[model samples]
Target: MNQGQAAAVFEGVYARRLDMIHRFPPGLRALGTRYIEPLFVAIGPYHRHLPRVQEMERMKRVAVHQFMQDTGLDWDALLAAAGVVAAQARALYDIPPAQNQGGDDPAAVQVPEAADQGEPQPHEQGAGQQEQNQDGVGPAAEQALGAGVQEVLAAGHHGIPLPPLPMSNAGFQEMLCIDAFFLLHYISMRDADNVPPSALAHLFYSRRSLIDNDIMLLENQIPFFVLTHLNELHPIFLRPFVAKLATNFHGHKSTRRIPPFQHHGYTPPHLLALLRFCMKEPVPAPPAPDAAGGPQQAPDAGGGPQQAPDVEDGAQAPAPDAGGGAPPALDAAGGPQQAPDVSITFTAIGLEEIGINLNVSDRNRFTDMAIRKRSFGPHLFKDPLLLGRELVLPQLFLGNVSSNYLVNMAAWEVCTAESYVERDTIVCSYIRILAMLMHREDDVHQLRAVHLMEGELTDRETLDLITSLGKHLPMGERYVRMLASIEEYKLVTWFWIAVHKLFYLYFKKIATFFAAIGSLAGVFKAFELVLVKKHQ
Candidate 1:
């Protein structure tokens, strides 16, 4: 191609948004590919030719046939609809076109398909056949496996123009439509009792966990638009059924409490995107500035006095002056005020000792939390003291798959949508805060005690999961400020408790000494009275 043609192609590729799905970065993949790559099946072009995942092609063919027959949809009609949006769907994937040609690769072993009941196809020869020939298997063994393979392949050819096995552009479009249809049908009928039996039904039932894991992978996704278009072309009754299936499969129950669709204003791009969206909390607008251009102070928990305009939750607060002079001056540019001490000296455990109850709230929406005073107690010389300071945290669920899923989502946000990092720092900030809180196994245990974490993993495992997932995440300026504030609050609380204990000890010692002195004086007075009576 000439330079002009090359430039035009480059422009065409770059100008469009093809970043919906991405392969894990080198650092993340270095940890392990098991979590990022599909293990049981390949749903999209990225993993279509992987040798290990080729066996699933047969199953996809079965699903396509069963789905078409049950729904009574014409095969050609599905292909025609998919063809209309083939280019649009293709643009959403990041894989190269050349990778879609499956038969050329020596490592990719295609499953053998026989044309007749008793005879194998003359052209078919691959790993399964080679094994059969070498083993000299009996006629019964050959008939059973061979008949199954033939049935699968026959269904592929008759049901969908594009089978899961790789082919030309036309075949690719058909693959998109068939794969999407399979997913929709499977999820929609997963709970139904009257579903017809097929190869897919058996695979899905026997290896449900494996299939679910693979489908959730970021790379193993078809464009949502393809699924939407196909659903639209189908019967009206099926559209809502498929949509509800998608929502139930991807949406978290905690997030469903507050519907994201109402707030996000746009539909999620795909299944993975839908799951990510459900987990996302609406980013609160930045707090407005006061007349002096500093953050407005919130009333103290006691509600008797307003504290120095409490800084925004994520912004840095000016360090309190040691000399008790005017509050440290706000920065001229309204940026974060410089603090004398930014180091974190305590953990959640320390905060707990200061009469702060660290209870897990039902709202596990990471961003949802508040610091509040639960009660006030009378003081000798001051206004009622804020007695119970509570840190209400959303319940965090950690499990075997939690780290993998969360890290991938965060990576997607960081790599594809840079603007989201600035606007919605909740995911990054939450991870960082967790990392900070769980610096040791004890921290995890403490959180578990408070029911903040519900997981079967050991304390060490929990810490490792958080640390590994949170590595390399950018700590936003707001997040830094928030940490600084928490650290400062911890230090102040620790000091007050220490001072109170010291005064209590001192007063107790003084009272004991006075009591001893008073007893001695009474004894001396009694002895003097006895001497006076003897003299009389």
Candidate 2:
């Protein structure tokens, strides 16, 4: 048979063998083993003998590692254990003599039956010794004997002769094996918190093969060929592959440049959060203004109402400003161009639509926790919430930040974002913060200036802003600490204390006023009642 035909036949036979073996009590409980064993045997010989099969197997192995890593499996250690088992098996049996029989005359039947001259054993030993001198059994012979014993044992237990390995589940196993390698490659290539873009890109492309192979398709349409049976495989062996991906893709970018907004300090935490919300998913514009036309535009920073853009969504109307107010800040020339107009668009795609619930904790946490354990940290995978949702798309944040604030905050400003831009400008916003903290010169002073700018913020507002910004900025923990420090500082403490005292005094006055009003009302009511009674 040609290789493909051989593969097909092998697969069919092995699958049948697996189905039969799985009927056994113990093997049935081990999970995936029935399929695994036959799958291995079917492909193992072909992998060794056929060049095409070998190449595909290698690719499959790599792809398996990658898939396992992505799925958060410990593939490396599992494969290592498998390797040890295979090596021991090989040492014990060099080559099966039965295999040498080559699909021919029923494998040299060695039916153990009574020998006719068995009673003459005493002298037979001395004769057997002489015979041993003529033909000494070596390791190879011993191995053959061992194989014979094993087959007999197997037959006794399984009630069937060990069939030639077939390729029943080759496609599935091959995919898993390839996934393991792909995962390993990514694990090895990872540097610090950042995953190599090339690696991400490569894995993304390689993943298509799983679908192409279609060995074990799932109802969900997610290729389950390898990962589908993850629970069936040895988790201990699978963990390392999962861990490596986690460690390698940590939140902070040690080498890459942070993106523009946070790097240049154009938008503070609040505006940044708003900008992020806008960039998350594109929103369809409000439906073209009705026949009467769009709502009236507020006066621009230049003191004249500018025409609003036509909206395409009939349901959404932009919130009207209370007054025709000017934008937040003005340029040196007092031009309207200096102020950024903040517009947020939210297109609601239901939770089911994405197959991931924004509110569900465990499901979201599992993917992240698995990655984190591998040592990537929160920075590797951004998790603004403990249970992560709202994945931080760096490109979107960067693009929006740039478009919104470049002119307002120049590169020369001694601002947080400017410093980031000075370094790697292509990296994500959070990564820049991490890099700055780790490697920047005059870090304390730079951060102090940023802190000064932060002082204008209210406690509730500032806290919310910082937390939201943490979703995308690699320096989430750092920002959290910095804000805590600001709260603890003597000036901030005094300010809070003064505010608290003022609140106490104000409440006291209001309470006294209410008491006085109550007394007057009571007296007035008594007087009115007495007058009415006298009149009656």
Candidate 3:
């Protein structure tokens, strides 16, 4: 090869590094292959020609025809526009050329069987024609291409009215356009008044649960740009509607309210990313410096740092910097120190035993959580038990599809080098936290009783799901730090529980003596009332 060609190829390879759609890493796929595989339909070239999913291609053609007829545009016009940028679109997927090529030569192609020609014309016998005939481009594909296009294909570029394209190239681009239109239509018609029901009846009535799940698979996605470009040619209004539909569809009722398209800076790479964006919470900024120029101490959700009262009866006090401090120093040799194993020894039920209340919060995202102390009346010798922690976590809807959706998102975050450890670890951290909390089916039952998890899945299934997620992905540094914080928090919480129990024990005798005094006083008052009645 010439130097110029080699240089151009090298540059192209470098440029494609930032492509959004990616193949699943081998580790992730091994954990659950079905999660990444498309069930009902394939949107991109990655799964386009799979034997199992090819039936949907016929449905796509029918949907495309209906879409064009409804929108008042010709099929050829749409195909021409798609053809103009077909090469660009093809480059977006990671499919190998050999797989797409069925021995079709770009220089020549066949006339469709549906064409009016009775016999094999002399010019139609090229290598491309033989390849197309062998590939069996189906009745639906031929009908979609139409007789005019086939005639142009049979006639060489010299005499043809349109630009030359291989049958495979033409078919793939058509597939992309039709698939994108189907998605757009499905999303836009959710609550539209003017749109006819007949236009989307087939899609709405199909195996919706399976299709909905498939659309969010990482490998099954087409780039958002292609959908947008196709939208421009049909109806421009559907663009924003697509985003709104996506926001409502994936999370359903449980999703956090993300602002409409204009205010948000996030541009989703595909459907899965779109759903992930909807659930994301904006990270709070660092606290600003005070007027004296010292670093400001961040307040907890309760508006101040939580303080634990002094321990009675000579118990150990919790370290003031337990949750916030750096790791202990290494030994004299300056090597890494091996800290003693620290873990949460208590379960959710154990916390409840010490008077801690587990309540589910209204927040839609799982990462939203806060621990606060509940207060009681002052004059009544206050129960130290009231100081027990109230754990508030976001409500999650768990079901059959939840595992697939979550695992793929977590896998995407782990595989992409561009993903930020702190910002993008939301799903990963949430899953890890679940793994830490749920040791068995009983833990799942505890969470469900508090309304923290609401769905059809049983406790055993939930436990299994948590177990699977924890095993597959490597823990990030941020997650490690979070684990340390959780351990410290657990230690502090246990200390308070111990202190509260001790204080209750100490006060029990004084409370019993007071109760006896009150009973005697009541008896004396009743006797006095009886004497007064006799005198009257």
Candidate 4:
């Protein structure tokens, strides 16, 4: 080979060497792939423009690869299989030199440093430094950098370069944020039993650091991490934590056996499911501004700023049938005690047990209960016949009537019934059912509560009942609003309808029996009179 051709071939081989970069640690693999790989390619051709420095970068890659392999990580398999470095080399070589893109200029592009190579050195160059080439430029001299090249270099140094390193998308970012959120959500939550608390704590701290500092990583890779941790977190541990959520949160109300969730009045099943998923997963910290003008931080974790304790003192026991009767009397110590007037504690539990989507049996049971009027009967005001017992009231009503208007109407109907025993059961059950239905990833319960409380008292039956109850019962000032809320749900109408229907049926039965007895007496008297006439 000619001297120049032989020299060019050797330079190319040295410049494309892949030793140094292959020696990174295992933990740095994802980081390297996400940030460093693209950068190597970007500067690869430029290095060739200055052959010696390009060779140095190639050597760095080899060093990184070796460093990584030393960790004994399985990630090495990824590199060997992908041939990512080789592909990058091929890509770089395929692109013609900048000068070659246009007509060839007789003069080479001479950078300024080469001209100053004749000057005396102020200080000795560091070890491994290359001497000035024939062009008179020291290999260590800083090259003129375009803005784009500078960005790529910056990304590399910060561990966020492009190419073989995967980039993040909006969805991926959201998932990361959610993962972080759940990590905190699970840890901050109580009942740490059977959980690897230390592992979770470390994970939260790590994720929090990444979130707080705004570290870059592949968005798609986040799900795997989230699922791994989430699988370890048991759903049972969240129950007591959620129970505490109900007591402190204003809109949340306790249901019977099943727990309460955050309520956003009109949320659908799909939305609630998404919300539950978020609660189960890690919650992400807020995102910050990025150098690229993209979000620098993760999205806000969806929850209230003031999280309540997951447990409470003096908490009443869950009632047998949801909304069985009035709660027991409260003693001076602010605890529930047995009351003579109220036999059983009212619970909202039945509402929680009922499925969001009811089957035919659920519908039949609810319908039969709704029609039954006797308080002592199977589906009435008995302890077992609680508001949410037969079926989830809000869910049932929602299923039967397919509109917002119908839902609101049903809610009003149940709330305004006259029988406090019956009315409260329905109202409370409806509230519990609605909360389960509307458990959004974010707290949306207040909106639903507010809507259920709005509007003027238009229904005469409810208005009259509210007026009557106010006069007879020694209700406090708060009771006015409470009754109004109950009235809005149409509890009064249901109570009166049941009472009137039962009374009407009772009178009809009595009348029919009396008429039959009177006919029998008249027939006996007629027979006696005929016999007397025959004897005379």
lDDT of 2 at 160: 52
**Quick one: how many clashes does candidate 2 have?**
53
- Tens-digit lDDT track of model 3 for 118-232: 2222124333222223222333344444553355445422332222222455446655666777776665454333356673555655656666677777778877667656766
lDDT per residue for candidate 4 within 316-435, as digits (tens), equals 233232223333355676433322332111222212222011211222111111211123443443233343222223112121111112222222223222222322233233333233
Quote the positional error of residue 183 for candidate 3 in Å.
Answer: 1.4
Better of 1 and 4 by lDDT: 1
Off by over 4 Å in 1: 1-19, 99-168, 192-199, 235-264, 281-341, 344-346, 353-357, 371-384, 387-389, 419-423, 476-478, 487-536
State the lDDT at 346 in candidate 4.
20
What is the alpha-carbon lDDT of model 1 when measured against the actual structure? 0.54
Candidate achieving the largest lDDT: 3
Which regions of candidate 4 deviate over 4 angstroms?
1-178, 181-236, 243-271, 274-371, 376-536
Better of 1 and 2 by TM-score: 1
Backbone clashes in each candidate structure, one number apiece? 1, 53, 0, 71
TM-score of each prediction: 0.63, 0.18, 0.64, 0.20
Model 1 scores worst on lDDT over the 10 consecutive residues at: 255-264
Pairing residues by index, what is the TM-score of model 4? 0.20
Order the candidates by TM-score, highest first: 3, 1, 4, 2
lDDT of 2 by residue, 313-416 (tens): 12233222111122223346532222122211111122112111112112111111101111234423332222212221121112211311211111101112
Model with the higher TM-score, candidate 1 or 4: 1
Measured with C-alpha atoms, the lDDT of residue 209 in candidate 3 is 64
